[model samples]
Target: MKLKFTLLTLFLVLISALSFAQKSNNSQSIISGKVNISKYHSREELKNLDKGELLTLYIERIEVIVNILPNIAFATKPGVTMASLGIPETKDNKKALEENKEASDTYFDSTIEFQKSILPYSDKKDLIAAILFYESTLKALHTYEDFKKD
Candidate 1:
């Protein structure tokens, strides 16, 4: 009876150990699958590009914003200069501020248009970067609008 009990206990321990090992293996596979899905391009792929080619690609996409919305470059100049000079925000600055706000709206509109035009041809990483940049620009524009209201 004593030998049978000991064998039974050993058998249970082996089964539990196998179960734990299988669980860990399953968890590791799940985590590795997630990592693979999150990364669209590996380091090796990005490294395959020739020097300046990557930069040229980014500039090419960005040029759509620059070219399509020339007003964005000049319309905000006065407000930017005033803010940089530490000039107090007063009623007199409202016109310039409003112009800046309009320019920002135009810029956001142009960015949406540019994304529609360029996204189909862009790499996954570039698309991700462009989206982040667009979000940042949108946030900045909102902030500017809030500042103008004050």
Candidate 2:
């Protein structure tokens, strides 16, 4: 009986130590900061992007910007258009502009779904930044390139 008690005590100590170590590691973990848009907008790399690639990069930039910003009030209904944080929009031609807007909206909705799906598993700081930056930059590059031609 004494031998069993000693073994049980040892096991409990080991479990306690492990639990404490896990908690400490969790406490030390840090989240990544938001991406800087001004830096990306000024980047020379953007000048070389073609229409399709520019669109993709623009969307990616938007995703990164969303991740870094405060949680926004999105619509509860699917397919509903929500306000952009603060970016201004100009419609050069109504029909063409609306079509472009619709495509952009669809992309944003898809991004929200994608973010929700993978965010649960990611913990690395750079991985999170990559996800946000790639998505946002893709979208931004697309829209800006289109607008520039107007």
Best by lDDT: 1
Deviation of model 1 at 14, angstroms: 91
Q: How far is 57's C-alpha from truth in model 2 (Å)?
A: 1.8
Q: What TM-score would each prediction reach against the true structure?
A: 0.29, 0.34
Highest TM-score among the candidates is held by which one? 2
Q: Whole-model lDDT, candidate 1?
A: 0.47
Candidate 1 residue pairs that clash: none
Q: Per-residue lDDT for 40-149 in model 2, tens only?
A: 43234554444444444454566445443322232211232312323223333334435544554566678857755654454444344554456554445335435546
The global Cα lDDT (0 to 1) of model 2 is 0.46
Model 1 residue runs over 4 Å out of place are: 1-89, 129-150
What's the lDDT for all of these models? 0.47, 0.46
Residue 6 displacement in candidate 1 (angstroms)? 99
User: How many clashes would you count in candidate 1?
Assistant: 0
Of candidate 2, the 10-residue stretch with the lowest lDDT total is: 25-34
